[model samples]
Target: MRAIATPGGLPISDPAALVDVEVEAPQALPHDLVVRVEAVSVNPVDSKVRLSANPSDTPRILGYDAAGTVTAVGQEVSGFAVGDEVYYAGAIDRPGSNADYQAVDHRIAAHKPTTLSFADAAALPLTALTAMEALEDLFHVGANSEGTLLVLGGAGGVGSIMIQLAKRLTSLRVIATASRPETAAWAREMGADEVANHHDLGAEVLRIVPEGVDYVLSTHSEGQIGAFAEIVKPLGHIAAIDDGNLNLSPLKPKRISWHWEFMFSRSLFQTPDIAVQGRMLADLATMVDAGEIRTTATQYIEDFTAAGIREAHRRIESHGTQGKIVVTR
Candidate 1:
């Protein structure tokens, strides 16, 4: 089978030499579904890993989000068949989806939305799961709300979905941060109640959530989080996808809670609740089919290859995309 993998530590945006290799085909494992990848979406982590993660032993396939067809299933699998189209963000601990065919645990697999193209479905898994986990699992804000949640970097993939989810599932006033005018507009389209500049987070958030906000979800955990500590309500929660060495002392007075949403924790640890992803995916499919949810895909390119994958990575690195970028096979 063909795969785009990194055999050495290198930057993306020119993965032609890094990717584009022929590898042996994968075999099915118990409770695993072998998918013939039809589409895959790029995320920030893909670039970070391609540049930073060390794969000393062998080539590392580095993609998590994909939409494809189940060509084969392990003996223990029951919900899908050989021809059933599926979609999922493959587990972080295992091989990724930047390949001709890949194997994923049954638990993390979700049916593609009946109304969406493969590219659209590919964009949802990682972002939707992250957003859902940040609210429903980490903060206990599901189906009920006492205060508003401010989303930082709300024009990106996870943030875009988070804005819509808060609107769909909770009554929380959705305040989002976007530094650019186009991004601010994108955030609003995704259902942000208000948009503010991320550069002046404290002042901008104060204008919308005057009494401070209930939670802050940052897509990029860049620097000086303490500088905006005043904006979070006392006993509020903070969730983030990006993690760097940083201090948390300023949040002490507010009794602020912190959550790191990896989105791959269950699969990485093989947790007892690994099946939750599958259930969540099924629910999202249902939501899409019922017109309760919509795809966040911004760019949908065709085929899975070196040039296309490189372009997707470049788009993400440019940090200008308002929504998801997907490439189909």
Candidate 2:
């Protein structure tokens, strides 16, 4: 198997930051499926792990979003079989999808949408899981739910799906924050009812909904906690998926609730409902086939080379790319 890995967790700018090498294929565990990866997408987590994670004796493979075909299945795997086309966000604790072959827990993997290409399908898993969990599991929004949702960072990878899901699955009046004109347009394309500048978040939101928003999904969670606290309605829910110091004192007065959404939690902890990730991805696949949810892969790397992967990491670290960046064979 061919793989791209970081030996010492070096910076992306380093020439040897990611290297291509030949390695033995992973064996399937009791609940695992060995997948032959066709396409993979870059996420912020990849860059974070590459730069700051503890170095490993062996090179560490760093990728989460992947679309591939199952070449072998574990003894306990039930829903998938050999030659099944599947997609998943690989578990954080395991060797990831940045290789020709990867062993993924079948509980978190689902059949890919028949309507999309491998690159497009690869872009949806991590972001779709995160957005679905943030909106439904954390915020308790559903089909009948009617309220306003302010999606922070509404033009990025997760935000792209968040905006679409909110509109298609729920009755929430969607408001999204995007600073750039192009991003704002993209957010609207994704089904946001209104788009506001993140620079003046409070004012921009207030202008759309006279009262505060009922829910806030902070995808880009840096320095926006205070603004979220100030702009949310009393007893509203706030969910975020970023790493940084946060102050919750501001939320106390309004009796607001805050949740941390890490899409990898279920698979990482081997939770009882770990299969929910697979279920959700399957449902999302249905939606995609029905033309309800669209892929967020705005940029594509034509070849799966070390240089291409490095450039993808560089763009993700720069924090300016819209939607998702996928690399395919």
Tell me, by lDDT, which candidate is best: 2
Q: Where does model 2 exceed 4 Å of error? A: none
Candidate 2 lDDT over residue span 1-329, tens digit each: 88988876688889788988788999999999999999999999998888886777688888999999999999999978899999999999999898999999998999999999999999999999999998779888799999999998889998999999999889999999999999999999999999999898878888888789999888766777788778999999988888788887888989989899999999889889999999999999999999999999999997787888898999998988999999999
TM per candidate: 0.96, 0.98
- C-alpha lDDT values of all predictions: 0.86, 0.91
Identify the runs in model 1 with alpha carbons over 4 angstroms from their true place: 13-17, 55-57
Tens digits of per-residue lDDT, candidate 1, 1-329, equal 99988765666644442568788988999999999999999999888887787656577888999999998899999899999999999887788899999999988998899899888899999999999889889988877685888898888899999988888888888899898889999999888889989888888788877899888887766664764588988898999888988688888888888889999998999999989999988988998898888889999778588788888888888888979999888
lDDT of 1 at 277: 90
Candidate 2 lDDT at 307 equals 82
